[model samples]
Target chain A: MSAPLFEKIALVGIGLIGSSLARVIRRERLAGEIAIATRSPATLARAEELGLGDSYSTEAATAVANADLVIVSVPVGSSGAVAAEIAPALKPGAIVTDVGSTKRSVIAQMQPLLPGNVHFIPGHPLAGTEKSGPDAGFADLFENRWCIFTPLPDTDPQALERLSEFWRRCGANIDTMDADHHDMVLAIVSHLPHIIAYNIVGTADDLETVTKSEVIKYSASGFRDFTRLAASDPTMWRDVCLHNKDAILEMLARFSEDLASLQRAIRWGDGEKLFDMFTRTRAVRRSIIDAGQEIDVPDFGRQVVEHPGAVMPAAKS
Target chain B: MSAPLFEKIALVGIGLIGSSLARVIRRERLAGEIAIATRSPATLARAEELGLGDSYSTEAATAVANADLVIVSVPVGSSGAVAAEIAPALKPGAIVTDVGSTKRSVIAQMQPLLPGNVHFIPGHPLAGTEKSGPDAGFADLFENRWCIFTPLPDTDPQALERLSEFWRRCGANIDTMDADHHDMVLAIVSHLPHIIAYNIVGTADDLETVTKSEVIKYSASGFRDFTRLAASDPTMWRDVCLHNKDAILEMLARFSEDLASLQRAIRWGDGEKLFDMFTRTRAVRRSIIDAGQEIDVPDFGRQVVEHPGAVMPAAKS
Candidate 1:
């Protein structure tokens, strides 16, 4: 491993992203001494049992004490509390950052509480699965994924580059953007999709005419795709909805308007209109696949059922 | 190969589902002879090149002339036209079936046209990927997947059993249900999900607020899941929406209502309500996984980027 990037690095949350960060830090030797802290004792003990850090504590302030860098990976809603708790304990010239879905709200919550001598940069890693908790994390979670920083205007350039270098060591490509712009981009790509998935799955469950068992049995057809996103962490998503309220509502309104028009087309037996919309959206998936955001699966990458007597090359997803 | 189950089997409209059926039948030696037909001459030529059949034709009538079993696998909207074209050529005691998502409409369209001497059975396999056309199919597409039949009340029991046996030989589990019930169940499990996916992807694409490139780049966070469903065969999905208008509309309405409440919760900053909704949806995903319809993946079976220092066995999806 290369020389340590920071003398001491504090991770203020030990859930999926936090634990993944800790794993990557240890793997790449990014920190000389790693400090892990979480509110729950069981989770802190689990982190210790996993040997993810050199030091551990339940108090956020204790974890950040004398740390050259502190990374907060909590739900966006708790940013203010964590910031207030750790503010007084942060070392001067320390680089403080967060991994939260929404950027603007996080900045609003943390910027005032953070000491003036410290660097406050807001960041979000555009990678994750539906899983949560420390055990759900893995070492390569951020590999080849984008980690975006919504740095404040007054942020130190050297501190930003140092953090960027740290994320680069964790195998992520980095991009910087304004906080409001980051929030809007994330609202469409992340927050709205989760809300919509949750809503549709809930609707399917509450159907009076169709039994839940049938829905569960045949979900492979389409509905199961939505469930993956719907199964994401409840607290994190709840916080996302509450913090990213305006942008999420805007996306929801547009999505519903588009859906109503689609409904009308179906109602009128407008096959041509339906076909056009269906066909148009296909190009978007192709673009995403072309850009490497999606895997190149001929199907939805259901490799288990694909080894049949067909002439096409097997896509062993 | 095993002994042929039928003297001959005819497949019309050689797209993903139809071609998969052809591959399975040929692999299992389910038919003495295979006759493939499609409206498109180019598609017929491609199927011939792929060795998907013993005989190829552009005429559905000619393909089914002396066949003991004919599986019409066209778009749902074309069910009536196909029935009208092949009605006179069907032999007495022959079994007729169509694999369509909307059973009631397919039955309503084909029943009146088919000869009374022929047994008309409606079947839908609850399996498919986003891929379409002959080249996208494989032999094991139906393996361990459900194939539901909405048979006519006056249908011959022996013919239904024979058709069911053919599917069983193709590695499918079979069930019988009312056509109306099949339509309603499928509206939730299949149709609405596709529609919602199409709508969301379309909305993201049409956004003046967010660039298309940005959406594509960040899609992995959540939007990419919906893109898979939206990338499904347009002609077939269009037909599904048009054919199952009532059920699709009903499901859309319910989905929209639930989504409205979710939007309200976000707008009003109702954290508890949002948390409850998000938490409840996770159980639906668990049930789907437990029922063996979905894999137990933290994500949508994406095994890559999961090497985050965990000891869990690799999910090589």
Candidate 2:
């Protein structure tokens, strides 16, 4: 590359999102030097062992000093703390951003702390697996994903475009919406799914008649799909639920009401109503697959061997 | 291979499960001849085109005339009608079984119609993908999966052994339980998950504030996993809910109660409660992955290269 995008980039709280950003940035030569920082000393040591950055520090202020860009990638609840820590050390023209899931609360928490000289654009990458930690991240985590920016009204256009280009280089498509709309949209799309998955798995776990082993053995029937979402980082999800309370509660209320209606249809033996809802939902999945939002890998095992073989794979797990 | 397990096998209802069973039977040399039948002429034609069986017919009686094994794979609501049509033609020693998701209802609907001369073992293979129809089937769908049998009190031991042997040959582990117990177990494991998935997807579809396109585009953010389970055949699920009403309603009520508590936790900003629930649920996914009951495929796009590359891929879908 002729020159790196920034002379130095400071990453705060190097967890899954943070480390993934580091990998993509290094892969694309997006920064001349990478500075990593986290609250935990053990995590900072792990980042160093992973060769994640050009410099490692346990102190956020030490990491952000003289850096052109600072990205806070901790849980949403920690946004304000990091912003306050790095505010005095931020360079005059540095652009400060975050990769939190909830936008409105993050904006409310962090905006008041950052100085007027820096651009504080709240963002969320509509990406990630349920797995977490530094090891769980990879350079392509954001590939073909959406990164939504909820820029405050006073945000600098040039700074916003610059951040957008950075995410684009990191293999994500970018969009912009206000903080409130972002929270509402995400409550239905992301928050509700995780809550439902966690709830169902917990319910299954607590069943006295149906042993836990039984649930685990027959999970592939339908229960296993929810488990993946339920296995997400607990701390991150707790923060999202706490920060986006109103929007999530709104979505959960609607979800519970819809489920009540479905339960009534089943109790009353209304096959027509049940069939209609199930049929309508199938169309949405088709649209998601058609929109290229899903992998469409075919959940069942692939039948290989064109001519002849055992229907089952030869090797058992 | 060793003198086919049975002289001939007849499959009624050539959908995903039926086609998959036919493929597995042929691969394992479990039958000398295969006969397929369905109420829909188009489905029978498609099954014939796919070479799913040696013979095809629209009449269930004709298909089961000389068959040693008769598998009814139709929707649960149609179980009684199929049993009535084939009861007269079933061979004296033939084993008649079903693969319906609900056990008690299938037994109740089919048992009285059939003669005591033939064995009626109600069975369900805990396997399937969301897609339906003959074209969507693969032989390996039931590999390492559970095939549960709900046998009547007077069912012949030899007939049960023969059918169990056939399922083992098809690469499934088998277990037997009473019909009522099977229904209750399945209501929590299979029926509830599908209902919740269908309900959430329906809620998303009916939302006026959040556009459908937005949900579809950002579905990789966790919602797409639910969509896979929700997209299952509508006719099949409608029958399941109607047939397993009491058990399903019980599980749904428990699920709703757990969800309401979770909603309150989020509303009251009880991060500790949220964290505890989210953490406990993660262990269940671990058990599922360990039990070899699920393929723990990571959800996001994999990181293909480690070094460096352009943000955009060469191929665009």
Per-candidate TM-scores read: 0.95, 0.96
Write model 2 residue lDDT over B99-176, tens digit each, in one string: 999998898899999998898999999988898999877788888889999988898899999999999888888988
lDDT (C-alpha) at residue A80 in model 2: 87
Over 4 Å off, model 2: A300-317, B300-317
Q: Which candidate is the best by DockQ?
A: 2
lDDT tens digits by residue: candidate 1, A1-317: 45799999999999999999999999889999999999999999999999999999999999999999999999999999999999999999999999999998999999998889999999999989899999988888887678999988898999999999999889888999998889999999999999999999999989888898889878878998999899999999999999988888899899999999999998888878999999999999888777666666654455453222212222111
Candidate 1 residue lDDT tens string, B1-317:
55689999999889998999999998898999999999999999999999999999999999999999999999888999999999999888888899999999998899998888898999998888898899988998887678999887897889999999999888888889999999999999999999999999999999998999899888889999999989999989988998889998889889988888888888888999989989999999888766666656556445453322212322111
**TM-score for model 2?**
0.96
lDDT of each: 0.88, 0.88
Residue pairs that clash (backbone atoms under 3 angstroms), model 1: A138-B308, A139-B308, A139-B309, A140-B307, A140-B308, A317-B317
Native-referenced Cα lDDT, model 2: 0.88
* DockQ (model 1, Cα): 0.50
